[model samples]
Target: MVFADGTERPCGGLLVPVTLHQRTGLAAQLGAALAAPTPLTAEGLATPKMPGETSVRGLFVAGDATGQMPSVANVIASGSTTASAIVGRLTGAT
Candidate 1:
C-alpha cells in the first residue's frame, strides 16, 4: 500500500474486492471540519442540502464532495442541480 508520506509496502496473494465507500473518505472529515449541515441519508450516505447546497451561503456541495454515493449519475445530478442554483442566484432569478 502506498501512503501519503511516500512510503510503500508489498503484499502477496491479495485476492479481495475492496469497495470504496464515502464514510471512509475525506468528504465526511471536511464537512465536519467546516461545520456544515450534513445529514445522513436513508442509504447511510452523508448528504448536504437537497439542492446541493450547504448551510453557509455561497458554499455549495455535490456528489462525493458531499459524501454521496460515488456514481456518475449522482455526480451529474448534483452538479446540474448546484449549477442551476448558482445560475439563478447570479442572474437574480430568485
Candidate 2:
C-alpha cells in the first residue's frame, strides 16, 4: 500500500508471505470490480435485465458489493448461485 507521500506501507499478514493469503482475496483474485446503482436496463420499450450479469461480460458479482443483502447467509447464497450460473453457462445447461 502506498500513501500519498510515496511511502510503502507494510503488507503484513498472518500468512501473507506464504500460501493461504491474509484474508479474503476476491478483488485481488478476480482482477475486476463491478458496480452499478441497480440492475442494468436495456434500451428498449420493455427489456429484461438478467440478474447478476455485470456490465463486464463474463464477469459477475453478488452480495454487498452487488447492492444485495450483506448478511453472511446472503453472501454465501449469492456466491453459490453465481458459481452455479457460471457452471451452467460453461456446460450449456438449461
Candidate 3:
C-alpha cells in the first residue's frame, strides 16, 4: 500500500501497490489499450465492476485496479473470483 507520503508497503499475491495515482493511471492505460470504459467515481477513482470483468471481451480487472477497498483480503478475493470466471470460460465450465 502507498501512504500519503509516497512510501509503499509490500503485500502478497500479484497485487499492485495501492495508490490513487497508480490505480487511476492503470485504469486509464488499460481502458485505452482495451478500448474499454473505466468508469470513475466522483473522487476520480475507478469504479469496480463487482466481478472484475470489463466490457472488453477477455479483459478483466481485479485487485487494486478495481478501486475497491485496498486491502489484501479484498484483493485476493477479487483475484480469485475473476480467475474462476476466466477458468470457467477457458474450460467451458460454468
Candidate 4:
C-alpha cells in the first residue's frame, strides 16, 4: 500500500497481488527492484506517522512494525484487535 509520503512498498510473501496501473518512472524502478529476486529487506518497515506523537494516541500498533506477526492474516487480525483495543480505551473499558 502507498505510505503517507506516497511511497509504495511491496508487502512480501504473496499476501496480496499488486496491479500496476500506470507505468510511471517510479513504478519502473519498483519493478526492477522486485525483478532482482533478492530477499526484500526490512529497512523501510517503520510506519509513516502524521506530524505529532510517535504513534496515534489510543491506537496501539501490531504486526510487522510492532514485531507482533509477519503474515498477512496475522496482520489483519492484529489490526482488528488494535481497533478493539482503541475502542475499549476510548470507552474506558480497558
Top candidate by lDDT: 3
In order, what is each prediction's RMSD in angstroms? 10.2, 12.7, 10.4, 16.1
Please give each candidate's TM-score: 0.48, 0.44, 0.51, 0.38
**How displaced is residue 94 in candidate 3, in Å?**
5.4
For candidate 3, the TM-score is 0.51
The lDDT per prediction is 0.57, 0.50, 0.58, 0.43
Q: What is candidate 3's lDDT per residue for 1-94, written digit by digit as tens?
A: 7889999999675643433434345545556233222332222323234375665556677676565665789889989998987887689775
Give per-residue CA lDDT, model 1, range 18-78, as digits (tens): 3443445343444432333334332223334546556555556666655555579998988
lDDT of 4 by residue, 13-84 (tens): 556543222223342333322111213322212223421111334334544433333579977876777667
TM-score of decoy 1: 0.48
Better of 1 and 4 by lDDT: 1
**What stretches of model 4 exceed 4 Å from their correct place?**
1-59
Ranking by lDDT: 3, 1, 2, 4
Q: Which regions of candidate 3 are displaced past 4 Å?
A: 1-19, 23-50
What lDDT score is found at residue 91 in candidate 4? 93
How many clashes show up per model? 0, 0, 0, 0
Q: Cα deviation in Å at residue 22, candidate 4?
A: 28
Predicted candidate 2 versus true structure: per-residue lDDT over 1-94, tens digit per residue: 7889999878765433222111354543555442333432111111113445454456666555555534689778877877776786678872
